[model samples]
Structures are given as structure tokens and as C-alpha cells.
Target: MTEIVRARGLVKRFDGLLAVDGIDFSIREGECFGLLGPNGAGKTSTIRMITCVSPVTAGQLRVNGMDVTTDRRRIKATLGVVPQDENLDPDLSVAQNLAVYARYFDIPAAVARARSDEILELFQLTEKRDETVDNLSGGMKRRLIVARALINEPKILVLDEPTTGLDPQARHLVWRKLRKLREQGITTLLTTHYMEEAAHLCDRLVVMHLGHILAEGSPQDLIERHVGGQVLELRIESDGDHADALAALRDRADLRLEDVDEAVYAYSTDQNWDPVMRDVASFGKAARLRESTLEDVFLQLTGRGLDE
Candidate 1:
């Protein structure tokens, strides 16, 4: 696949504060790429640069072989952006919203109507076409916002925290639509703190922290490389030889232990847990063994949860 977006030594600054600290990454055509991190991790700043909303302080940034610095107009023309905050026009009806946005791209009125109808059907918002934006539910509003972004039929879809504030069913519905778009060869770039969203939608992702890229790989690959195959979570108790149990587990070369607030997480590459379980039976009151996921990998690398 060809590279649709590329950055090398990218830097962003507001006065003396460095938001994106010389990061480098690339997005291939038709693949869903993600920037996974907590807020203030430069995910939004990076997206702003690519979308031509902010100037890059330094380094090279390109989209579809065009330089971001010199080709802002050309770049913006081919990109569909969904911002973190809702920006839909509340006074306009759902169909009217899409029609007005299409005019921004200089799309013909007749063609815009055809495209609007097609996109509304794609997002399952056809029934809400004539309803005013203010009358829609949160999920309906989100779907309409997404539908409006596609009014230009852009080559690359850029979403910043696409599923933020959505309920489970609504989020899942949006996820399904995004997956369908990916299958149709629309390249996607998204910024998200939702571990499951990134794991489900992104083909590759970079873990960002304090405006730096900490790790980059497929979700499963990152999990295997950082946290391992299985995780054993044991609640730490002040009484009953818990410290001794921890010390015993630490003695084993095969286990990696991470101590968070009220629990100790044991990571192991080996699938078998019988031996490890025996060592914790005496001290642990609540123990859970489960498959390691992107969340575990993030906690291991960042020393914090995604929301923190």
C-alpha cells in the first residue's frame, strides 16, 4: 500500500510549551491508523497539523505526496475531518446540514442532494433527514456529524476522538459504519483514548505519552511485546503474608509484576497459570486471570490508565 500520510521529526509548539515533541509516523492508504493516548498527549495537535488547522512549528509533514506547509488548500480538499467537539448546526434539519456543508466543497446542489441521501442511508440516518438537529439524540447527532464529514467524498477520513461521549450501542453502531468504510478503501486516521476502539478499528497504532511516541505496532503485537499473553490480577491485602507472596512471585524469572493502587498485576508469556495460581492462593483474596489486552500494554508502558 502507498503511504497516504507521513511525518518525520514533527514538532508543534504554543509559545514555550511543546505539544508534539518531534514525533515520526506514517499512515498507509486504506488502513485505519490510530494515535492512542490520554488527553494533552499531542494526538489532537498532530491531527490539526495534518488537517491544516494549525501550523507545524518544525519538521516535515505530508499528505498524499503534498507538503502540509505549502499545500494546505490542496490537502484540505481531499480530507474529511470530524472534530472532537460537536459542531453541527442546530437550526438546520439533518438533510439541510449535509446540503450546506457540501456547498463548502463546491459540490453541485443536485449532486450534493444525491450524495447526502446516499450517505444518510449508509449511516442509518435516513429516517432523521428532515428532523432538526436539536431534536436528535446524542447518537443521532454523532452519526449526522460523521455523515456531514463525508459530503466532500474525501480520500482520507480524519477523526479526533470519534466515539467520545457515546453510549455503548451508539459507539458500536459508529464502529460498524467505520469498518464498512475501511472495507471500501477509505483510509482513516483517528485519535482515541478508548483502548477497545483502537483495538477494534485500527490496523496499526502509536502509543503517545507526554507528546512523544512510546510504542508503535498492531494492537495484538504491542500486547505480546509489552505485557505478554496472560495477566493475573491479585488484589493486594495488608494482612496475611501478602508481602511475602509478592516477594515469592517476584523471585520467579518468568513473571513481570506491576503494582497499581490496590492490586498487583502479573504478566506471563506462558499460557499455563496453574503454577502461578498456587503461589498466590494463600495471600490474594480476589484473583483474576485473563488474556492480556491493549489496556494492559498501555498501563505497562505509561505507568497509568488511559483515562488518567
Candidate 2:
């Protein structure tokens, strides 16, 4: 695979606090790679260092084969970044924001105008092209930010929490756009707390926790390796005495179990739903079983929900 982004022992520190401890990873060209972690996991700090907005305190970092320290300007020109926050110029009209950013790349007026026009239409922002940025809705502004990132026709795209606050429809729309970009072979590196988003968009990902690498692989590979392919969630109400039954079932299946407030989770790769159902049923109607999801694996591994 072609290497687009590479980092070795990357580290960052602020006020003597190690925000991003030594971590190493790489991104292949034309692939959508993910950085999955909860808040304060150093994902953002790593991005800032790789993007050259902040200096790395230790180790080597490269983007598009250029050294971040010596080739900062050149690397910046070849990359596009969309921060988690919307940093749009509120005073400018929607189209003008892209126009201005295009100019930052030293793109000529006529060409920049054409590119802006094409992207506005591409993002379905043509209808709002004349509206002030502050007047646009959150989703619209987000689409605009993505459109602006493409103004440079970058070789790699970096998105931090791209769909954090979007409604379902808007989130799906963004996913469609990203899929199109993947089809066009633009390498993308994304950081998000949403497990579903990572599973849907990332071909491979690295899970980070407390500035350390926990696991790395394709979403399906991680699930099959770290988390089983199938899971059975059971909620039982046994008048405050549920440990014995839960422990018996957990050992019988030889599965990992998680004890939440009112339920115990069982996970296994085997495709025998009947056994899982029967096991729960043996505990009486107090047990309820349901299929597992990516959300379950994330919580199981991280000990915290994605939204938390």
C-alpha cells in the first residue's frame, strides 16, 4: 500500500502534561483510516501535530512523504483539514468562504470561482450560496466546511469528528459524500467517537485510550478479534439476587460477560441464537435477550459509552 501519512513515536506535551504519548501509526493512500477513542484520548492532539498547526515534542512525523518539520508549508498545501469545530467566517457569504480559502492556496480568481461553483453544486449549497454563513443551519455549515476543504483538491483529507451533531439525514448525506471521495481515491484520516461511523467509513482503524494504542485493524477484523461476531444481551430482574444465575450462564457459554446496571451481556462468534435464547429463558422471563452491535463492543473495550 502507498503510504500517505506516517508517524513514529509521536508525542505532544502541554504544560508538562503529556497529552499524546508516544504512538506510532500509518495511513495508506486511498483508504479511509480512523482514530477511535473517547474524549481526552489524544486523537485531536495527534491531528494537530500531524497537520503542522502544533509542533511535535518527540519522534518523526510525515504527511505525503514530506517531513513535517522542514516541509511544513509544502505538506500543508497538499492536505485539507476539517476541524471538529465550525470555524467558518460568519461574516462572509457561503460561496465567499470557499472563494477566500481558495485564494489562500494562491489559486487564481477565475479558477477559484469555477472550483467554488463546482463544489457548491456538489454539496447542494448553490441554493444558499448567497446567504451569510451565520445564517446557515448547523448541517449546512458542516457541508460547507467539507466543500471548503476540497477547495485545494488535496491528496489527503483529515476530518475530526465530522458528523458530531448532525441529524440522521444530514449524517447520512455526509457519509454519502465521503463514500464518493473514497471512490475517487482520496486518502482520508478521521477521528470520531461514533462506533457506527467508524465501522461504516473506515476500512481500518486504531483504537486509542489514555494516549496508548489498544488495538488496530479493520472494523470487522477488530470485532471478530477483540469482540466476537455475535452477542446476546440479557436483562434480568431477580429481586436483587441475580449474580448466581448470571455467573452460571456466563461460565456455561464460556463467554465474556459485562454487568451493567440491570443486565448482563454475553458475546460469542458462534451463530447459534437458539442456545443464547434458551440460556436466557432458563433464567425465567426475567431475562431479555437482544442482538449485539458495534456500540456494545466499544463500551465493552473502553469501559465507557461512546457518547460519554
Candidate 3:
């Protein structure tokens, strides 16, 4: 696979504070790559620099073999962007919205109309073509935003929190469309707060926190490497005796333990969970265990604390 985007020591700063503190990564063509982190993790800042909407404070970034510094316009031209918020003109009709956004890319009127009709049908929004933005459902509006981005026929599609506000069914629908785009060989770079979104869409991803990459790999690879195959969470009651319970398994070198308030999370790799179950049995009915997930790896690396 070809490298579509490359960064080395990529840095972004604002008023002397470093937002993206020198990160390095590469994205492959025709694959979905994700940048995931909690708030204030520089995911958005990095995206801004990649799109050339913000200047790089230091280091090098290249998009499609073109330097971001010298080829800002060229890079922008090859990229399609879907922002986190709905920025569509509410007064415009569905078709009107795509036509107006297409103009920004300097797409000709005839070409824009043809593209809009085709994209609308592709997204199952053809029936709502002439409807005003206010009348469209939340799902329709989001699909429209994506359709507008495609008006330029970009090689790379950048989506920020694509399904943030949608319900389960709507989110699933968007995921299916994105998967179809990937099948068509479009490179996708995604920044999302939802862990499941990243897991489902990305072939690979980097977990970032405080402007640095904590880990990078496929979602399953990450889960296996960081948190192991299974997690045994032993929840203790608020007034329960945790010290005595922890002492039962303290000598076991295989368990990675985290004490979050009254909750005790024991991440283990031993697929044979009988040993861990015995300890949980010691804690009576206050304990339970289940399979670990990508979110577990994220929280393990980035922490459970809320950022602002």
C-alpha cells in the first residue's frame, strides 16, 4: 500500500503552549486510519495542521507526497472534510446545500448538479433532495454533510466525530456508508471520541493523550498487547473490605490492577480464568468479570479522569 499521509515530529503550539507535542505516524492509501483520544489530547489540533487550516509550529508533514508548507492549496484540494458540528446552511434545500458547497471547490454548475444527484442517491437521500435542511432528520443532515464533502471528488476524506450525535441505527447506517467508501479505495482519516467508532471503521489507530501517541496498532492488536484477552473486574461495595480482597491476589504477577474508587479492575491474559474466579468468589456477590474492549485499553492508557 502507498503512504498517503506522513508526519515526523509534527508539532502545534498556541501562545507558547504545545498542543501537539511532536508526534510521528503514517497513513496508508485506501485504508481508514483513526486518531483517538479524550478531550485536550491534540487529535483536533493535528487534524487542523493536516488540513492546513492551522500552521504547524514545527516539524514536517506531507500529504500525498506534497509538503504541507509548500503545497497547502494542493493538499486542501485533494482532501474532503466533514467537521464535528453541522455547518450546513439551514435555509438551503438538500440539493441547494450540496450545490453551494460545491462552488467553494470551484466545481462547475453542471458537474456539481450531477455529482449532487449521484451522491444523494448513494446516501439514500434522493427522496429528500428538494427538502429544506430544517425538515431533514438528524441522520439525513449528517449524510448531507458527508455528501457535500464528496462534491470535490477528493482522494482523502477527513471526518471528525462523524456519528457523535446520532442514535444507534443512524450511527450504524453511517458506518456502513463509510465502509463502502473505503471499499472504493478512498483513504479515510478519522478523529473520534467514541472508541467503538474507531474500532469499527479504522484498520489501524493511534491512542493519544496530552499531545502524544500512547500506542498505535490495529484495535485487536492493541487490546491484546495492552489489556490482554480478558478482563476480570472485581467491584467492591463502598463499605467493603478491599485491602483484604486485594491481598488475596496481590502476589499474582500476571494481573494488572487498577483501583478506581470502590471498583477494582484486574486485567489478565490467562484465558483460563478459574484462578481469578476463585478470588472473585472470595469477595462474594460483589464481583463480576467480562471480556475487555477497546475502551478498556483507552481508559487504561489515557486514564479514567475526566478532562475539563
Candidate 4:
């Protein structure tokens, strides 16, 4: 697949503060590429530069072979952007919102109407076409925002925290639609802090922290590389037995431990967990063994939770 977006030594600054500090990454055509990190991790800053919303303070940024610095107009024309904030017109009906946004791209009125109907159906918002934005539920509003972004039939879809603040059912609905879009060959660039969202939707991703890339690979690859195959989470108590449990885990060369607030996480590639489990059985209230996930990889690489 050809690279649709690329950056090298990219930097962003607001006065003296450095947001994105000399980073490099690329997005291939028709793949869902994600920038995963916590708040202020430069995910938003990097995407802003790619979408031409913010100026790059230094380094090279390109979209579809066009330079971001000199080709802002051409670049913006081929991009569909869903910002973090809800910018839908509250007074406009659902159908009207799409129609009006289409004008910005110079889409013909008749063609815009046709595309609006098609996209509304794609997002399952056909029944809410004539309803005002203010009348829709949070999920409906979110779907509409995404629907509006497609009014231009863009080549690359750029979403910044598209599922933020949505309930589980609503968020899942959005996820389903995005998956459908990817199946139809729309290259997507997504920035999100939600581990599950990134794991579920991204074909490949780069973990960003404090303006730099920590690791890049498929979700499963990162999990295997960072935290291994299985995780054993043991609740930690202040009792003397807990110290014994920690000491026992440290004695084993195969196990890696991370001590969080109330839990001691044991990571290992060994499938035989019997010996490890017995050592921590009496040390805490509970113990759970499960498959390692993207969250575990992020915590291992960053030494903090996603929200932190």
C-alpha cells in the first residue's frame, strides 16, 4: 500500500511550550492508523499539523504527496476532519447540517443531497434526517458529526477522539460504522486515548508519550513485545504475607512485576502459572489471570495509566 500521510522530525510549539517534539510516522492507504496516548501526549498536535489546522514549528509534514506548509488548500480539500468538540449547528436539521457543510467543498446542491442521503443511511441516521441537532441524543449527535465529515467524499478521514464521552452502546455503534468505512477502503487516521478503541480499530499504531514515539506495531505485536502472553493481577495488601509474595515473584527470572496502587501485576511468557499463583494466593484478597492487552503494553511502556 502507498503511504498517504508521512512526517519526519515534526515539531509543534505554542510560544515556549513544545507540544510535538521532532517525531516521525506514516499512514498507509486504506489502513486505520492510530496515535495512542494519554492527555497532552502530542497525538492531537501531530494530527492538527497533518490536517493543516496548526502550523508545524519545524520538520517535514506531508499528506498525499503534498507538503503541509505550502499546500494547505490542496491538503485540506482531500481531508475529512472530525474535531474533538461538537461543532454541529444546533439550529440546523440533521439533513441540513450535511447539506450546508457540503457547500464548503463546493459540492453541487443536487450531488450534495444525494451524498447526504447515502451517508445518513450509512451511519443509520436516516430516520433523524429532519430532526434538529439539539433534539438528538449524544450518540446521534456524534454520528451526525461523522456523517457531516463525509459530505466531501474525502480520501483520508481524520478523527480526533471520535468516541469520547459516548456511552458503551453508542461508542460501539460508532466503532461498527468506522469498521464498515475501512472495509470500503477509506484510509483513516485516528487519535485516541481509549486503549480498546485503538486495539479494536487500528491495523497499526504508534504509542506516543510526551511528544515522542515509544513503540510502533500491530496491537498484538506490541503486547507480545512489551508485556508478554499472560498477566496475573494480584491485589496487594499491607500485610506481611504481601511482602513475602513480592519477594517470591522477584526470585523468579521469568516474571516481570509492576506495582500499581492496590495491585501487583505479574507479567510473563510462561504458560505454567501454578507456581506463581500459589505464592500470591494468601498474600492478597484476589488474583486474576488473563490475556495481556494493549492497556498492559501501554502501562508497561509509559509507567502510568492511559488517563494519567
Overall local distance difference test of candidate 2:
0.85
How many times do residue backbones clash in model 4? 0
Backbone clash pairs for candidate 2 read: none
Q: Which number leads on TM-score?
A: 3
What lDDT tens digits, residue by residue, belong to model 3 across residues 1-308?
88999999999999887899999999999999999999999999999899989998899999989999999998999999999899999999999999888898888999999999999999999999999999999998999999888999999999988999999998999999999999999999999989999999999999999999999999999999998888877777754567766777677788888888877788876557787788668677777777788999999999999987
Our model 1 lands, by Cα RMSD against the true structure, at: 1.7
Question: Residue by residue across 1-99, what tens digits does model 4's lDDT show?
Answer: 899999999999997978898999989999999999878889999989999989999999989999999999899999999999999999999999999
lDDT values, one for every candidate = 0.90, 0.85, 0.90, 0.90
Q: Write the per-residue lDDT of candidate 1 for residues 1-308, one digit (tens) a residue.
A: 79999999999999898999999999999999999887878899999999998999999999999999999989998999999999999999999999999998999999999999999999999999999999999999998888888999999999999999999999999999999999999999999989999999999999998889999999989998888878988876664445665786898888888876677889977546898888777655577788889999887876675544
Summed over model 2, clashes come to 0
Q: Where is model 2 more than 4 Å wrong at Cα? A: 238-241, 269-276, 283-291, 305-308
Error of 3 at 168 (Å): 1.4
TM-scores across all candidates? 0.95, 0.93, 0.96, 0.95
Clashes of each: 0, 0, 0, 0
Give the TM-score ranking, best first. 3, 1, 4, 2
List all candidate RMSDs to the true structure. 1.7, 2.1, 1.4, 1.7
Relative to the true structure, candidate 4 has a C-alpha RMSD (angstroms) of 1.7
Write the number of the candidate with greater TM-score, choosing between 1 and 3.
3
lDDT at position 112, candidate 4:
99
